[model samples]
Target: MDILHIVGQQRLEGTVSISGSKQSAIPCLAAALLTDQTVVLEGVPEIGDVATMIEILETLGAVVTRQGDMVTIDPSRVESMPLTGAETRKLRGSIYLMSVLAARFKQGVVGLPGGYAIGPRPIDLHIKALERLGVSVRNEQGVHYMRVDRLVGNRIYLDLPSFGATISALLVAVFAEGTTVIENAAYDPEVIDVSTMLTNMGASVKGAGTDEIRIKGVSQLSGCRHTLIPDRMEAGTFLTMGAALGRVTVDNVIPLHLESVIQKLERYGALIEATDDSVTATFQEAKPVDIRVFHYGGFPSDLQPVISAALLQAKGASIVVDKLYPQRFRHVQELRRLNARITHEDASIIIRGGETLLGTEIEAPDPRGGAALVLAGLLASGETTLHHAEVLDQSYERFDQKLKELGALVWRETI
Candidate 1:
């Protein structure tokens, strides 16, 4: 295992370019398997989850090559096979392989996925959506075996707007026989990026950033080069870090995707300047503000932890209501370990600021939560040692290096 040694009480300053979206890269890589030709993906982050996905692809006979931030995959010789149970249980996103393989081949098998144990996240939505597309799915002792003679597209009305299910549906629907309409689909920006990649590859997909997504299956998809969109969550995390610590300019990010986060930070007394593709966040001092979070098109649930960090140093109490992912407050315990005064009741967290935080040993519960802990560590007093720091690698690219460049005393050490 590896631990991160972080020296606290340092003001962060520097311009850091955000990495590509890990959420977008995973499904896009799986989408490449639908085509026999080589697909060149630029700006792909070199992260643990992505590396695992690439390894899964290689095990299925896809010739994959990596050069810096670029990944090239040739799936001409790829075959459908069951992913190893161990590998499948490593990351939740690995379950997406089921839809891709099932769409490409007549039969596919994969075990249940596992990632950070924040709460129970079942794949029933995925299975239900797959069944709607004519795929017969069966689960035996935690392993999912699926078979589909032919995929004939049909209207799929998701019970809830799930990002994973929407992406999985898009992956399989791109190669199906007829038009597939996904009603009440997730309209996340990552979904838009995947739909854009598919459209470039001759797959007719429209209404990606809306509730209704329509996919017109093409007979064959040609290989095409595509660059992934900037990671909004990564951009938001740094923005929140700047709000908590000091004035920091984050470059190479799309400003529009961060509108909700930037607005929330602005409400919390952070100065934000947005350009076409970059956002600069500067904090003079922490000011107290009331934050009310709603559903999508409002404050997102992913930024809740870092937002809570910002509120920790504020002048008054800040109320955060997470309409989505009510159980995402696992980071609150870790924040409390650093001396933050936070009280949680139901789906809301009330933060009372003006409390000085002292660093201590803590563990990251998940990727975003790990990021919030790192931000808290950077702003706390004394040294903070973070165990299981590898969890941060699941998303952020060169996270420690970026933090170090911003004058943070953070280093990775093996234990």
Candidate 2:
């Protein structure tokens, strides 16, 4: 494993280009399994999660080749083998293979998904949605086995607006025989991105970016070239860092996807300006603000910890709450090591601002939690040794390189 070596109190200012959306890229990668023709994906971020997905694709005998950020996947020789081993457990998106495999092969076997131990994600929705589509699903020990005598389209009403469930239903429904309607679907931009790509691949999908989605089943899908949407999480990270440090400009970001975060940062005392594809953040005196995480069109739950950490220097107290994952306060203890006054009360993290953070060695709990530690490290007094920081690469593409580009004194070394 590698650790991030950071010299604190060095301002990271300048422009940083946001990479491809990790949320969008993975599903689009999984969608390739539905076709035998070649699928070319541009702007795919070079991140750990994407790498793991590509590795799984290769393990299934998909001929995958890469050139810079562009990935060409030919599933012509792919097999619906049982998904197991370290690769499956390394990424939570491994379960996404279930839909495409079930659609194309009528049977699929996969191990349970793995990701940050923040909280229990409702994967039952995925199984339930598949079952509603006339698929037989059962779990033996931990591995899931799914099979269908015949593919038939059916209506699926998600209990929650889960992004995974909506996309899973869409993937399987595309190959079914009849029309399928999804109610209370997730409204994330990634859902729209996946639908866009699936449409390009000759699938008929409608109302992707809404609570209700209608999918007319097609006999087969062909591959096409699709460019992924810009990553909003990575874009929000730059804005958070800029608010904590100095002026920063994040390019290649879609302002509409980050509307809630942009508004919140403005309230928390960061001078923000946005054009079509760029957002510039300038440091201002920190101010206390309350943030509540909701689904898309709301404050992103993924950035809860990072934003909480950035607000540590605010003039007053601030509250960061996540209804989606209350246990996300795992970073609270790590932040306290740097003299941060924070309290975890159930679903909320109360941050007491105005305390000078002292640099020291710290361990990251998860990806976003690690991001919180990174911001705290940059704000600390001296050098901060960040251990177990490799988890940050799971979502952040070339993190240390991007920081160095922005003039931050940061580097990575093997532990």
Kindly report which residue stretches of model 2 are placed more than 4 angstroms away from their true locations once superposed.
none
Candidate 2 lDDT over residue span 187-212, tens digit each: 89999999999999899999989999
**Model 1, range 1-415, lDDT digits (tens) per residue?**
6799889888888888988888899999989998899999998999988998898889889999999999999999999888866777887888888988888886898988887665557789899889888889999998889999888899999888888999999988987888999999999888999999988889999899999999987778889999998888888998888877887788889888888888878877888887887888888678766655544577777778778777888868888887566788889999999999989998788899989989999998888888888888877889998888988888889999999898888999987
Residue 130 CA error for candidate 2 (Å)? 0.6
Clashing pairs in 2: none
Task: Compute each candidate's TM-score over C-alphas.
Answer: 0.96, 0.99
What's the distance in Å from true for residue 99, model 1? 1.2
Instruction: Report, for every candidate in turn, its global Cα lDDT versus the true structure.
Output: 0.86, 0.91
Error of 2 at 360 (Å): 0.4
Candidate 1: where is the Cα deviation over 4 Å?
A: 289-296
